[model samples]
Target chain A: MIAEVLTIGDELLTGNTIDSNSAYIAQRLTERGYWVRRITTVGDDVGEIMSVIREILNRKPSVLVISGGLGPTHDDVTMLAVAKALGRDLVLCEDCLERIKQFYEELHRNGLIDDPTLNEARKKMAYLPEGATPLENTEGAAPGAYIEYEGVKIFVLPGMPREMKAMLEREVLPRIGERKFIQKKFLAEITDESKLAPILNEAIERFRVKIHSSPKGFGKFIGIIIFAEDEAKVKEVVEFMEGKGIRFMEGW
Target chain B: MIAEVLTIGDELLTGNTIDSNSAYIAQRLTERGYWVRRITTVGDDVGEIMSVIREILNRKPSVLVISGGLGPTHDDVTMLAVAKALGRDLVLCEDCLERIKQFYEELHRNGLIDDPTLNEARKKMAYLPEGATPLENTEGAAPGAYIEYEGVKIFVLPGMPREMKAMLEREVLPRIGERKFIQKKFLAEITDESKLAPILNEAIERFRVKIHSSPKGFGKFIGIIIFAEDEAKVKEVVEFMEGKGIRFMEGW
Candidate 1:
């Protein structure tokens, strides 16, 4: 299955913040047997986000995970953009608003905040793209959204690492798939680069797997990763190479 | 003044790598006064890379900085993709081949590799799109390419962070014009969100500046960043906000 990742935030485009969110999301999606074909980062821009979403939809990825811009700030326009892209509207979730109110009230009780009232800004977090199922936020006030549009699963998550991770584990992964994205790594002991080159080419030709090899200082060992549909396929490719005189070390 | 970043690597798409190169490039581009609008990542597949490059060129950004997939591997097809996207042929860069030969020879001398022969894999790094100038790679064997096609300054650099940084500083930055990208951050003392929201919105309205404000908790201070074409514009927005009773703290 093919997937795409979209990260939204001006901080990312400004280079003030490195987008570690997409990496984490991509890793999770890859583990779920989704080939993350394209990953895009854009600012907190409605038009840009909407147009990118449209483009991704046109490409027909099975799933699209969008991170960031789901905050209470004025620039947090991902939900609005998502609505517009899908030709929907923004609708307030009463359950989400209630949870947000209680979240702040609990914080107020713990002396973390001076006020417990939910202003318009905080209330904005409760508004999601119309028809999106509200995914509970265990770590923060902003709840994520899971919407399926035109057979494509679209997920909207927070930008904060802690919150995004919690939501992905609790709400996102269970919905993607059970197929495993299996890849096995090995260190091949090879003194001659020429001997291994042909073997590597033959392995690629024979097996329906993607092999990545990087020379580890070019001395006696090179690191190789075999990715396939299942663990057995990875092991099969490894054994085929080993049979051709490519010895695998105990560790990489 | 607009720039886009395209990073090519299977490692990046598979989440084996975090794509720090784009952030570093974007930061440098931002320092050179280019507003990095979007950052995209794709695998080493030539067709995928070529399609994305064409899409980026169609967007007509003033600059497009592409990093990665310049190494000597089966998957390193960025140079080929770039050539195809620009409707040019891959011409052998003789000087680049000489440098690659010498680099491997030096490695062989240093006992890093068993052979220094210019094999097909190593020699493949010497090819470039027709009419493109080879950008010297001081840290590695592969030489980067800088080509201006249809008014867009396209730079293709190595994926290795060290090599990419060296080429960017020594070669890429000199060719791009000198324009400062300045943003000033301040910690504004404000206890209420309602108090600073108007000031921030007003500041955005008054100056041609991009303002970002994040609450540092429900506490007495919020972080603000004013971004503009020049330093004076940023300072002007800051002063206008300060005049509206927003007290600035010394540090973040």
Candidate 2:
């Protein structure tokens, strides 16, 4: 399976905020054997968001994960963008409204300060697209929404790291857990890449491995990663390089 | 100015490594009033790297900041990728070689203990594409390279945050300081967006304002921002909205 990540926020694009969400999502998706082909960041502009979503959809990733937006603020328009990308209308759903009301009541019962700002934030969560499945947010007031349209599952989560991370772990990962993939890394310290060129060539020829060679600065360090579905094939390639007098480094 | 960020690494795409490099670049670029349009992360695959570089170029981003693949390891193929993207041949520069040698000598003097592994790391940093300008890295053995090809200024920095941040702050930012841009942000609570919609339209018609309105969940928790060249015009729009009973939130 393949996925693409879209992080929507002016803060990220303008450098007011750091985007740790996309990185975290990409890492998790890769570990699950899904290739995240591209990651995009754009301002809160709906047109830009729509263009990016359309472009990535044409590329046809099975899943598209979007983080940011989902706040009760003016720049939070991720859900709107997703709907526009799918050519769907931004319709407020009854379930979403109930979710928002329940969330507010819970907060009020918990003696959390009840203010207009909090209510507004809760109301924004209630305004989701029609036919969208609202994901429960145990971490924050913003309830995440998931919509499967055009054979692509679009997961819309809040911009807050705590909410996004929790929802992704609870709601998204399980749905994407069917695929299998293997990753192997090789680290070696070699100064002269030209000298090792012949050995690297030989190793690739000797073993059926997807080998990638990267030589670090002025010849002080070298690392390689061989990825493949077959563990034996991966090990064989690593063994071949080890036989060539290549010493492995700390991180496998 | 507009910039695109390309952070290359299998570790970054994988869950094992967290990519703090792109965020660092994005923050620095945004601070300089440069809009980071997109961030692309690719594995060590040469074809994928080439495609991403081409796509970023097609978007006409003035600056392209790339990190990773500068290590002295077999997997480090950033320089090779740069060469392929720029259609340049890799050449070992004598100046870079001398820099590498000096770095090794410094390590030895500091009792860092020279090993074959360490020497190999330094050697890989010496190779660069033809006509590339080598940027020195005082923190590490790998020296970064910068090259302007076909109107796009490409910056190749180390993946290590400390080294990359230093080079960016010292070398990159100063060179980009000549450009002029003004950033304006406006925030308002959820005041009837319908009522403010026409006013925003009028403001956009009068001044070159990039206006975006997002609902935050309640009647008073709407957020909006206007980016424009004129500071006075931006403030006037906010004040106009405030006079229309639109409460200004923080970030104005």
lDDT scores of the candidates, listed in order: 0.86, 0.73
TM-score of chain A of each: 0.89, 0.82
Per-residue lDDT of B193 in model 2: 52
Model no. 2, DockQ: 0.35
Estimate, for each residue in A111-200, the C-alpha lDDT of model 1 and write its tens digit.
988788898888999999889999999998899999999999999999889999999999999998877667777888876555776888
Judged by DockQ cut-offs, the docking class of candidate 2 is: acceptable
Instruction: Give the per-residue lDDT digits (tens) of candidate 1, residues B1-252.
Output: 899999988778778789898999988898777889999999988999999999999999999999998877666789999999999999999999999999999998998777888888788899999999999999998999999999999999999899999999999998999766677778887756567877788888878566777655544467787777787887788778778888887456
Q: TM-score for all predictions?
A: 0.93, 0.76
In angstroms, the error of model 2 at A184 is 9.7
**At residue A133, what lDDT does model 2 achieve?**
84
